[model samples]
Target chain A: MRFFINRDRFVHDVQNVTKAVSSRTTIPILTGIKIVADHSGITLTGSDSDISIETFIPKEEEGSEIVRIEEKGSIVLQARFFAEIVKKLPGQDIEIIVQDQFATTIRSGSSVFNLNGLDPEEYPRLPQVKEDLLFRLPQDMLKNLIRQTVFAVSTQETRPVLTGVNLETEEDELNCTATDSHRLAMRKATIERNNESLSFNNVVIPGKSLNELSKILDDSSERVDIVVTENQVLFKMKNILFFSRLLEGKYPVTKGMIPTQSKTAFKLKAKPFLHTLERALLLSREGKNNVINLKTLEGGQIEITSISPEVGKVTEHIDSIDFEGEDMRISFNGKNVIDALKVVDSEEIHITFTGAMSPFVIRPTDHDHYLHLFSPVRTY
Target chain B: MRFFINRDRFVHDVQNVTKAVSSRTTIPILTGIKIVADHSGITLTGSDSDISIETFIPKEEEGSEIVRIEEKGSIVLQARFFAEIVKKLPGQDIEIIVQDQFATTIRSGSSVFNLNGLDPEEYPRLPQVKEDLLFRLPQDMLKNLIRQTVFAVSTQETRPVLTGVNLETEEDELNCTATDSHRLAMRKATIERNNESLSFNNVVIPGKSLNELSKILDDSSERVDIVVTENQVLFKMKNILFFSRLLEGKYPVTKGMIPTQSKTAFKLKAKPFLHTLERALLLSREGKNNVINLKTLEGGQIEITSISPEVGKVTEHIDSIDFEGEDMRISFNGKNVIDALKVVDSEEIHITFTGAMSPFVIRPTDHDHYLHLFSPVRTY
Candidate 1:
């Protein structure tokens, strides 16, 4: 392969593809990035058998020449060294030439590097999916959906299915849910589908794959197409395609875990409550259980306290914006509550509790589209 | 101790003292910060037995009340939690009260924390050094002097004396040197002495202690008083006094290692040469030895190359502004050269070599304040 391309754009595309490359992969060839240069453009692919990311740079962009191709061929270079070298290359344009025995020469300015390249044929092929079952959503909305639910996924391998986020689509609404059996986070957004009758409820994607995809997608409102198949899902943006394997086994039904009734309810500013919980967690975190107690008092006031026997105790008081129902006390993992409050977009937050020992619900007061549920700890 | 002090200033002083506190210390009391509030002001001290840092906040500074002392007492609180709490406290001023049984209450805004405190009497006492042998130098100059020599200290414990920087004073100049048997760095600066006859030839301060002291001193031209004694060295700043235990033993003689003559010499821009070596090191770093070769060519040109048998090769070419003597080839550790180049303040760097097997020297072209010497590796 022989081509000269713009250095900045090439670096950007390489970084996106390398997100799927893992240094711990057992397959030796998986540690290399596959690059192909054709008449139209150049394509870079990286995969670890579980997640694959491929990005393409065309010969011309916006009436400006981005790449000048001298020959059409393919080569795979070691990802770690190649990425670092290209990022620090000293010229505006980079030229690559492949010689006999797959010895590639990279030249930019006064520096020249010769790297041993592996055969591109040894790289794994990405899964193919038909575009028949496709849906579109704004890039910003998809990023938010991933961020709101991915942190709640179980990190343990004993329940492998719970390590992925469950995506369910009915009509035009898409609901995403993740749970580690201790806390559950659910977010819903309206998506545009090619077929109104298309629906799926068992698509569980690894939370790690969603996190990588979120990093690559910008916060623009441009639409991105997603296609779902029996065992794989593909997210296609401008000139990039991301593929992830679907987890095996059925996801547990979590609708019943959310509380529908409340013995006590209160509304408070999200930011102040988040700060209070953060301070309380500093002490409770030293206790190893991250437990903090909350008690509602007269005159719409709430007291939050945490105690670590060996360290010290922290007490915080915040006045509620509104209060109703019976006064009650409950204890919970402050870290979980802090996570949910950070993603809440509204100014005010509403919390509902059935009792001191049961699960409770926390939601943005201005919207019913997203909510978080937590299982209270028995600290009495 | 009961006092309400400016939260920002309190946080700053706590952070400075906590640098001397380590969690892995064998003594439990050493993990806590000792605070003594007298009629004048409050003093915070932290010690790990080897190094102690104490900072004072008076009742008034520059016509402003910084501390209000309601009572006189002393107590010690856990360094880790106290530092974190004071940094995130939500009020303009923080009130600390030591109750009966050493139970302390810290209040700011609506947040209150009751921490378990230890008796201040158990904290280690700082060494008392007479100020007869005192010298003063600009804080910026001392900071630079430490940075230029500390990185060359030996990290291995086989030779405990080599792990410290040797400081010697004669006349009005202070000379500092550090070496790890392979490379040596020396820096010198002029100081204002209280007694012109006061001099020391064997003051070895631990590299780790100098590194910590460097972080606390800002880059200002204000004067800082330094006093050296038999077993301790004290640095007294405006309201901060830092004491470090000196390392015992005789330092190695390193003056004869730097060559006084040369067979080949060259001068080049410091930044560009640094960039070239950095790029060459990228390939050599993979070989684990960090060895790169430099060969002089005709027309005042130089070639730099590094080869890793299993990976690849990198070749860089540059034109020196000045070249003299015979053409020669030498191989040295690229990382060591890069470190010296980064700290060279002069725009042009001058290098001299006696031969391929002997040690070479690198110095700033503008002055003789600092110089670095490196031993060559036999590659042929």
Candidate 2:
């Protein structure tokens, strides 16, 4: 590729595509980033089999020249070292020239780097997805959904499907659920799309890819176009294309894991509840599984206690601002409560318990768009 | 101990001492912080065998009462958890009451924590150092000297003494030197001491402990008292006492390793040279030793080159702003140069090379107080 491009713009685009650059050299070509310059623009692609990210820098942006391409060609350079060099190069404009032999020269300011470039033909092409089954959603909403549920996805690769977040659509409502068999987090939001009454029952996108894409998405208000095929999913936004390979197997039906009814429910301030749970977590560290007991007393108060035979017991009484139903006691992993409390933006949160052995649900006092369910530990 | 102390003051003191607290709980009691309350004030001490830090919270400060002691006693509480709890606790003043049954009640704001406390008698006693061999130095100057040389110390504990920085004093000059055998860094400053000319030969203080102490010493302008005993070194400042156990054995005579004469010398802008070295390091990663080659061209320019058989070669040229002695070329560990340059505050640095195989010295153009030496690696 022979092009003169704005260093900052090129650097920004390179960083976005680098999110999918493979660190493992198992597939040597995948460790390099493919760069192509044509009449349209300069395109950069990075992929690691599981996910691929491509960013395009147009010849001109906002009436300003961003890139001037002299020759149409392609070359692949080592992703990590190239990115580091480009970032540290002291210049405002960078000139990249590729010779017939695939030798690349990057000159900026007073520094010029001659790097060995690989034949881009050796690099694997990104899978193309049909636009027929496309949908649109606000980048911020999608990012929020990913943040709220992705943490609950199983990190272990033993069950590959569990490591992906399940995304299902019924009519206009999109439900995102992630569970590790222990705790489940689900977020539901409505999106405006051209497709009518569409449903994706068991579509599972790898949680790791979604997390990486979240960081790449800069403008939250911009609507991103998502196209889904049988095995590949593509997110296109503002000259950047993110493609992720979907999990093959069907995702487990986590809907059955969440309770539809509750036996006892109480409203507690999110910040205070989080602080009290943190204190209990200190004591819980001495226990086998960092378990803390939550007891709702006769009055509007919750007593969080953790005990260890050798490290004594700690009890923290937090007054409940609001309460309903019957008083009850339950024990759970203190870390679970801490995780659930972090995403809760509401001043007060309502926690409901179905029974001693059943999963409990925590939701914001005013909204139903997000819900967190925790499987209570059976403490003997 | 029964006392109501200013929470902020107490927490600050506790945090300083807790820096020396051992993370490994092999000796369970060692992980706990010892607190002793007297009629004068409360003293908190944390130790990890090799290093101990003691911080004293006086009963009064700036004509204001900081601690109101109700009784005199002592107890040991878990350092890590206690520091976290105290930092997070919501209160201006914390009430500490030690019961006859060895139960400690720490009340702050609306929260009350009843912790199981151990007898302080079980805690290790602080090492007593005679004040006769005391010296005084500006805290900031001492910290700067430590920072300049500590990073060059050997990290591997194979020869335990090499992990400590050697401090020697002659006349009014206090010299500190550290080396990993491959490279050495030395810093010297003039200081006032009670002894006319005392030499602390082979006195090695652990690099890890000095690093931690450097972070704790925030007020560099304050005077620091240095007390040396047979096996311990104490740095006493206002309300804080940092004690480090000296590493046994003779430190290698690094003075002999430094070349007294040089065959070639050059003056270069420190920042630009650092940037050039970083660029050369990128290509060096492909080699077995990650070595970069430096060559002095016919013109007033230096060429830095690195080549990998499989991954291409990189050549970067930096114009020499100034040159002296003879035209020469040398190669060394790029990482060592980068590390040494990070501590150099001067704009211009003078590099003196004895020969291709011998160690080279880098120092500020006009300063004699600081010097950094790096051993060159054979590129062939």
Per-residue alpha-carbon lDDT of model 2 for B1-380, expressed as tens digits? Answer: 69999998888888888999878857778989999899899999999988888888889999999999998999898898789878877779998888976788888875677888887778878887888878888888888888899999998989989999998887788889999988889999988788775557778899998999898876558889898777889998988889999999998877777788988777788998888777777777667576877787766687877776665666777776566567777778888888899888899998888888888999998788999999899766
Distance from true location, Cα of B367 in model 2, Å = 1.7
DockQ of each: 0.79, 0.51
How far residue A105's Cα lies from its native spot in candidate 1, in Å, is 0.4
Tens-place lDDT per residue, model 1, B1-380, is 79999999999999999999999999999999999999999999998988899999999999999999999999999999999999988889999999888999999998999999998888888999999889999999999999999999999999999999999996899999999888999999999999888899879999999999999999999999999999899999999999999999998877777788899999988988898888888889998999999999899899989988776998889888779899999999999999888888899989999999999999998899999999998887
Residue runs of model 2 more than 4 Å from their true location after superposition: none
Tens digit of per-residue lDDT, candidate 1, span A227-327:
99989999999999999999999999988788888889989899989988988888999989999999998998999999999989999899997798898
Each prediction's RMSD to truth:
1.2, 2.1
Which segments of model 1 are wrong by more than 4 Å?
none
Itemize residue pairs with steric clashes in candidate 1. Answer: none
Question: Which window of ten consecutive residues has the lowest lDDT sum in model 1 chain B?
Answer: B252-261
Of the true interface contacts, the fraction found in model 2 is 0.40
